[model samples]
Structures are given as C-alpha cells and as structure tokens.
Target chain A: MDKMNGAQLTIKLLERFGVDIIAGIPGGSNLPLYDALSHSTTIRHVLARHEQGAGFIAQGMARSSGRPAVCFATSGPGATNVMTALADAKLDSIPIICITGQVPQSLIGTDAFQEIDTYGMSIPITKHNFLVRSARELLEVIPAAFRIAGEGRPGPVLIDIPKDVQLEMIEFADWPAMPQRECVKHYRKQDILQAAAMINAAERPILYLGGGIRHGNAHDAAIRLAEKNNLPTTMTLLGLGSMPTNHPLALGMLGMHAARYTNLILEECDLLLVAGARFDDRATGKIAEFCPGAKVIHIDIDPGEINKLRTAHLQLVGDAGSVLAELLPQVESKNRQDWLNRMAFLKKENPFIMPGADDPCMPYGLIRQIAALADHETLIATDVGKHQMWVAQAYPFCRPRQLLTSGGLGTMGFGLPAAIGASLAHPQKTVVCFSGDGSILMNIQELATAVEQRANVKIFVLDNTSLGLVRQQQNLFFGKQYFASEYQHHVDFVTIARGFGMQAFALGASDDPVATLTKAMQTQGPCLVHVPIGRNEEVYPMVPPGAANKEMIGGENHASA
Target chain B: MQALKESYPCPPSDASGQKVLELTVNNHPGVMSHICGLFSRRAFNMEGILCMPIGDGKLSRIWIQIAGNSHLDQIVKQLEKLEDVRSAVLHPAEHEVFAKLEEYFQGS
Candidate 1:
C-alpha cells in the first residue's frame, strides 16, 4: 500500500506527468502545498513576483513547448491575480493546468481570511475545474485535470484544493495510470471529399490559417496543401508562423493591419479553405463582407467553432492535421497560374510598405535588424499594442511555435515574463520579447525573475511614450482626441532593468545603434534594449473597426488620403 | 435590496417563444453553476430550470427553458462544450418537461 497526503500526491502526480517547472507564489492557504513541493527534487519551482506573472510564465512554457504547463497560486488575491492569465489561456486555447490552494473546508464560506470561491470564479474562465473535498479525490482529480487541459480543443483547467484537503492523509494500493491523448479521428469521409471537390473546382482559393494550425501541429500539412493546390495563403495574427512569411504563396496576415495586397487578395478569392481558424472579428472585419464571394470550408477540432462566427458551407469536424492529410490525397495537383498572376499584380500595386525600413532606428527598421541578427530558431514573443502589430507585420517567422503572443486576450505585460518562460523551457535557444512602453510596465517586476533565473531573454522595449494603438484609434476614429492614452512623463526602462540586476542598453542613447542592439542580443543573460519610436507612427492598411477588409486607411498606395 | 430586486424583475415563464434544453450532466456541487454561468455570461435569457438526479445520483437531468431565438443554436453548442455536461439536446417550445411544472409555479 502507498501512503501520502493530498499535497504529496498532487506533487507526485505532477512529477509523473513530466511537469519539471512550476511558476507561482506561496501564501498562507497554500503553505502545505509549498511544503510538499519543497521535497520534490525533479520539479523546479520558479518564484514569480506576482501571480499574474507566474500565470503568463506558465503560458510561455506551454505556448513554446506545445505542452500543458502548471502554475500555483494561493487563495483570494493570488487566485484573482492569476485569473487574467487563465482567461487569456482559455481564449487562445492553450493547455495550462493551474492548481490553487484554497482556504480550509470549514473556512471556505465562513468569511475566513484569504477565502474566496475559487471554483465559482474559475468556472467561466477554465475549460474544467475541480474543488477537492478530500485527500482521496486528489488521485482522480489531478489526472483528470491534466487530461481535460490537453484533450481535444486544449484549454486552461483549474484545481482548487482546500488547505484541509491538502493536509488530509490518504492510503491507496496503486497509482492511477497516465491517460493517453484521445485522438478522435472521426470525420465524415463525404465531408472531406466534398471539401476537396470544392477546392479542385474553385479557380481562386485562399487558405486562411489561424492559431488552430499551430495547436494541431498541422503546419507542414497546411503548407503542403497550399503548395500542391497553388493556393494563396493568408494567416491570422496567431497563425503567423504556420507558413514562412517569405513563401511565394504566403500573403502574410489578413484583415486588420494586413498588407493591402493580402486583404485585397482575400476579397477577390472565390473559396476560403479555413483550417483550424475561427473568423475572429479582427481577422474578418465586417463579417458579412469578409469574403463576400467566397465559399468556406472550415476544418476544426471543436464542433462549436464550425458555425460559431461565419457559417461554413462544408464543416469537417476533426483534427486539422488529420483532415488536411485526408483531403490532400483527394485534391488534385494544379498550378492556378491565373490566380497567382492576379495576386502578384495586387502585391506589386498595393504592397505592404515599411516607411522607414532602411533606417536601423525606426520601428520597422529595428524589427528587421533584430530579425536579421537573430537565428532562425529564435522564439519571438510580443506584448500587445502597436509594437506587437509591427512585429507581426515585419517579423519573418518560419516554423510552428516560433512566435508567442496574447492573440485572444491582447494582454499587455505578457511579453517579458512569457519570454522568460520560453527561455527556461529551451535554455539553449535565444528568446526575444518585443514589447512597448505601455505594455512592458504592466509586468516589469518580472525582470527580477528573469535576471534571477538567467533566462537568456532579450527584451526590446519600443518606447512610443504612450499606448500607441489606443492613441492611433483616437486619431482615426475618435477625432484625434487622445485622452488617457499618451504619457506625460517618460520611464527610463534601461535604468529599471539595471535596477533588477539585468544588462541594459538604450539604442537611442548610442551613436551606433546596430552595435548597441548587437551587444544586447549577444549578452549571455537577460537584457533590455529600449528603442524610442515616434508617437505619431501608426500601423497602416488598418481596416477600421467594423469596416470591411477592403476599406483600408493608411499605406504606401493610400498615402494621400 | 428592494430596489435592486425591483429593477431586475422575474423572467416571464410563458411557454410561448420558449425552447427547452435537456442536459445530462455529472452530479456535482458546481455542475448547476457551470450550466447557468454559460447562459448568464453569453447573455442568453433563461426562463425556467428544473433538475433531478437520475438513477444512482451519479448523473442528473437538467431541463432549462430559455427564450427561443437565433442564439438558441449557439447556446446549445456552448453547453455541449462544458466538461460536466454529457449531452445537451434542444427541444421545441411544446416540450412537456417545463410544461408539466407550470402548475407548481402558477401562484407561488
């Protein structure tokens, strides 16, 4: 017979499930869990400054490794602090397991210190949640949490264990075996053949890829299908790295902030072969007019997502990779030279123009220089705002799991900590976080955590001295009444990084900006590079909110009006 | 509290324009909350609800009467995604589950 407390059992189960790193903070309610975790030799706990940082750090690990990662938080404030990250993960469909320590059973609803209804609060945000009543329930709940987090349509799962339950003793004869990933390959053959027929018959087809492509690990299959069918492909922000940005058929990101040519190509397509991508409003501006003339064939694991946004003519409910693999055989090899020629014409006419791409000091120019210096294997993470959009536009991401950003939640302060988590997951590879002034400050405390772990994360702060995206929105739509968007005073991120015991450099302060950036990138540990950006610089070819994809605002071709 | 209660009046329990969803779910403390939370968060109006344990108390059958609209399909789809919910079957307004319980709520 085996004997252990719930806390010990939980830690043991996590070790069995191959969880090596856990990011979290310890508090009164979760002391027993910390005590049990202390004895674990294999599981390394990363102490984050805030629970939110820990949550995002775990997100970083999960997003980079394509595995379910774990995080811990105490009850009440700790739990609340981590809620944002949980919601963020839920929206993006990232599999992450959060184990929170709750107040004892007796104190749960008695208005006790550090008591909150963690279970009730997490129900909406998590894919599945558990409130352990006894130590014995730990065995079933822990494995179930892992299963639910990683199963079909992966998402965040929460397990709130009361303190008394954590300390309760349980004796059992055997440990539960780890559950195998249930790969449901049950898709209709008729649907697949019909989708293939639609693709074969269509003269102009565009493959619209999203985060689901990365989640299903269908990058190679998607690329193959695109190339074989001679389909022009446009990716959503989350699906940036599915196809190499430099590929001939790659139209880059579509919808809002997309290149004029890409959105225009989408407008002209007769068929949209959507793989693992939901038609998010940002990706499909003015849904009725998104692809007005195109027939859609959407293949996703989640049945609910099929007709959730824009209804598909053919819905192939199965894993994206599996569906694509099946559809590949039925699809005929054809060179649609007419469509390609038209796309090339649009590209030549309405190209994505970087205004100051040649200068190393400009926003687009700096992103290009960084991309040039960084190796192909380097993982890029971005915080939300104009800088994130710029990186998504300019960065040449080549493979799946290459770029990690908060696509669904659009959370600020995600880049630095997420980059740290990625660096921890892959210690040998370089992790770069492209952040902006407004976004970086939201979780700047994590700089200390990055330094302490020596996570080898290079953070580049694109300092526009404002919430640039919000300011740009006010500029375009709100009559340029920038209220509460611009910062009155500037923050010196260089000195702040140095304060956190990190190597810091300022590109604006240096005579040779390239050398400064190179030195920062070459640094062996976590470093920060602050690049000053013009406040008025706006992301061009923006589809105004609620506007049609074809109705673009600013770009090279539309510079006058 | 009185003003708050007055501001949020009880939903009309009329069978007209109502759709019934029969859900088979795991019997647990938070299972009801999970179902109701989905409806509330999605802004779908629920008119009536009835739940009872089936057979061995391990599973429960919940009947939710919601206002029938274009969003009913979406509501059913979202309910099917819930982990605790085993199956969510939508029925037309004339479904007898909530109709049979109308007598209990008539004058209470």
Candidate 2:
C-alpha cells in the first residue's frame, strides 16, 4: 500500500473518470489542491480570472460533450462567486462537478478568515454537496458526486474539501467500484399504447419539444415521431436544436415572444404531444388559457415533472428516446393535409420577420448575416436580454445541443465562457457567442481565459448602451419611464479585448457590419467584434404580461418601436 | 428560519397540521444534504429530521416532520426522483417513528 495525500487521491479519481481539463482560480485555502494539480501531468488546468467564469466554462463543456465537467474554487468569496453558476446548472439540468477548498475542520464554525460554511451556503444551489471530515471519505465522496451529477435528470454537485483533509496522508490500496444507478424504465406498456392511440385520433397534433430531448439524446426519435405522423413541431427556448429549424414540419419556438402563427396553432391543436418539457410560465403564457382545448400526452424521465403543473392525459415516465422509439412502433403513419394547409396559410398571412430588413448595422440584419455564414456544425451561445431573444427568433439550428444558452435561470454573461468551453471540447468546431454590451461586461474577465486556451470562439457584442429588455418593458408597461437601464459611460469593448491579447474590431453603426463580423469569425483563435445599435430597438411579437399567447403586438405587418 | 414554517398550508380544521415524510435512500455521503437542500431552496421548513442506516450498510431510512401543505405532496414526489432516493412515503403526524424517538430520548 502506498501513502497518498487526500488531494492526490482526488486528482487520481478525476483521472479515473476520464476528466482531462479543469477550469479554476486558486486562493489561500486551496493551495494543497493546486499543489497536487501542479504535480499531475494528465489534467490541464485553465486559470479563469473569476470563479463564475470557470463554472460557466465547465457548463459549456458538459452541455457540448454530454458528460459531466469539472470546476474548482477556493472558500468564502470563491465559493460565493460560483453560486450563480450552480443555480444556473441546477435549473438547466447540466451535469457539472464543482470542487472548492474549505478551511480546516476545527475552524469550520469559528468563522476563520476566508471561511464561510461552504456546505451550508451551497445547499440551496447544488443537487448535492459534501464537506469531507476525514481523509478516507474522499474515496466514497468523490465517486458519489460524479454519480449524482451524471445520473438521470443530471445537475451540478459540489464537494468542499477542507484544507487539513487535503493535506492528510492515508495508505491507499484499492479503488471502489462506481455507484450503481437504477436503469429501470418506469412507463407502463399500456401508457405508450394509449398515447399512440391519442396521436392517431387527433387531426391536429403538435409535438412540443424541450431541452430534455437533447439531454436524453432523443433528437432522432423526436424528429421521426414528427415526420412519421405528419405532425408539426414547436420548441421551448432550450429546445431550439431538438428539431431542425428549417424542416418543413418545424414551427419556430412557441412562447411569450413566439411567432404569432406558432401560438395560434398551439391554441387550436386538439392534442399536444409534449416530450421532455416542463410547462414553464415563459413558454406557456397564462397557463390557464394556454392550449385551451388540448389533451396532453407528456413523456419525461423524471416522474416528478409528470404532473408538477399541468396534468397530462397520459404520462409516460421513461427516457424520452426510449419512450418515443417504443411509441413509434405502435403509431400508424398518416397525413393531415388540411392541418398542413392551415399552417401554410397562417405563415403566409402573418409572417414573423425581424424589425430591420435592409440595414446590416441593425441587430436583426447583422444576426441574420452571421447565421447565414455559419454551417450546421457551428455551436452558438447567447447572453440574456434582447440579443438572446433575437438569436432565438432568427437563428437556424439544425442539430441537437448546437445552441446552449441559459433558459431557466436566464443568467447574463453565460455566452463567452460557455462558448470557450464548447470550443475547447471540440477544437475542430467553430463556436460563436452573441452577447449584449450589458451582458458581455458581466463576465468580461473571461476574455483572458479564452485567449490563454486559444479557444476558437467568436464573440459579437451588440452595444445598445442600455439593458434592452428592461428598457423595452419599461417603455410598454411603465409609460416609458426608463431609469438605471441606460449606460452613461463611454466604454470601448474592442479596446478591452485588445488589452486581453486578442484580435479585435470595432464597427460603427454604418461601417460594413456583416463584412467585419465575417472577417472576425474567420480570423482564428479568439476575437471580438463590437457593433453599436440604437437604444430603441426592441423585440416584437411579445405577449404582454397577463395576456394570452395569441394576443401578440407585432408581426410582419406591424413592428413596434 | 421560523418564518418558513409559518407559510405551510394548515391542514383542514379536522386533522392535525403536522405530517411525517419517510424516505428510503442509498446510504451515501451527501444524501442528507440533497434532501435538506431541496427543502431550503423551496423555503419549506421541516420541524425535525431523523436518519439511520437500515439492515445492511447499503441503504438508509429518513423521517422528516413537517407542517402539512399543498406543496408537501410535490416535495415527496421530487424526493423520490433523486438518484440516491429509492422511495418516499407520507405518514400521518401520529406515526410512531417520531413519537417513539421522543420517548427514547426522554428515557435516556
């Protein structure tokens, strides 16, 4: 038996789990772990300027590779900084393991310097968290964290390693087997048959897709179900890439800001075949009135989500891929031409178009041009606000997991770090981040991380000089009395990028925006393009608060300023 | 923290307001934290919690005393969905687990 410190054993377990990269920043409490990391040749550490950036970077890798990713931080401020990302990952169900160094066990409750109850503070944010009291506990705790993080309905898990525990030496001889997770599917055979019967009988069936399809790796099953039955498909914000946007049967996203026709179709559908979706308030405006006359056939792996909100007529609790594949054999193929014709007519009668049609300097025109330049393999991420909505509305995503953005938490500054993670996960692929000026600054410190890793990520900052979403809401709902939303500073983002040792370009409102953006995307390693737009540009086709989805204010005929 | 307890929906005038939630879960390092975390995140307070390993070292049973509310049922369902949790059952407030434990502590 060989004597090894707890820190050394932790790294060995990570290696055993096939983790090659970790994003983190070191502090006083975590010096032992960093010391161990320095000795290891297998794990490459990317030093993030901030802990939150490291967390989101881990999220990006997990979302892209469909595997649990790792991040590290120290105690107190380090742990607090990573809180938002933990909450974000928990809500979005991305599998990530976060390790933070804690004070010695004896000093845990004495309020030692740089010590906060990392375990207690993390309870509300993490799916599970640990504070290792003994060196030997690492053997079980490390494996348990990984199991909880990567199992069904995956989420973020935390392990707070005390400084003394990391330094303690123990004679280690054997490694334990991984925890056993139950793979027993929970849906009854009769439920799938009943759902198929409902699908067969309904004349107008809309398949409501969600992020679970991507998590469950059920994209093929979802597309086959839609095409086999000639059913139209609609998506939640995180469900964008579940069905190819350009497919003939695909209706764009359905939500508060969804296209008018998609909402109209949802309101009229006789059966809503919901797959892997939790009926979020944003997706279902005024839940009482949403899909007023539809029988829902809900399929999800988490039994808790089956009837958490809206009760389903038939609930099938299993992996979306398995359930959909099983149900496919029971379903009989049929075409409803009258329903297809109605969809085509609605699209023709009321087309969903961006506000700016001709000028590339405008936000919509610039986003359209960028989407056109990228291929289906391109991975895109967005920060919160109007830019996120614009990209969600207009971008054409052709594959599952290609679009990674914060849907449940809607955290700002998620785009850049996430894009960096995606780029690092697949170096051969292109990753683009569409960000607002307000959001890019939230985690702007991560530009240094992207430069260090040489990640192939292109960041476009839409400088509206204000929090566009908040400004728009204030204008419509609060008599245009906007305060604190507007930025009074003259901060130059391109200068900041150049300062971080990255290639950068700043385009004026009239400068060839498309050409500059295209050049930046092709230039290589990491680059940024700044495009300024008017403050008044707002997202349209918005269903006001307390309004039904069909009562939209904008479409092709009307563009609200 | 006490304010969290006040928010629980009181039982109908005829029944006791407290209920016991029993959970069977894999005996692991951080399983307790996950259950407690769920309650903390929702701001749903539990009056008391008891945990003990079962026959073999592989599994454990947890009993939580909580005020009854509309949200309690949903909480039980979610607790059962955790990877470590095997089953979650609700018992009346008069269930013997807590009452027996109280007698043991008092006698000791």
Q: For this target, which candidate reaches the highest lDDT against the unseen true structure?
A: 1
TM-score of 1: 0.96
Q: What is the DockQ of candidate 2?
A: 0.27
How many steric clashes between backbone atoms does each model show?
Answer: 0, 0
DockQ of each: 0.32, 0.27
lDDT of 2 at A320: 89
Reference-based lDDT, residue A484, model 2: 89
Q: Which ten residues in a row have the lowest lDDT in candidate 1 chain A?
A: A179-188
Candidate of highest TM-score: 1
Each prediction's whole-model lDDT (CA)? 0.90, 0.86
lDDT measured at residue A172 in model 1 versus the true structure, 0 to 100? 98
Clashing residue pairs found in predicted model 1: none
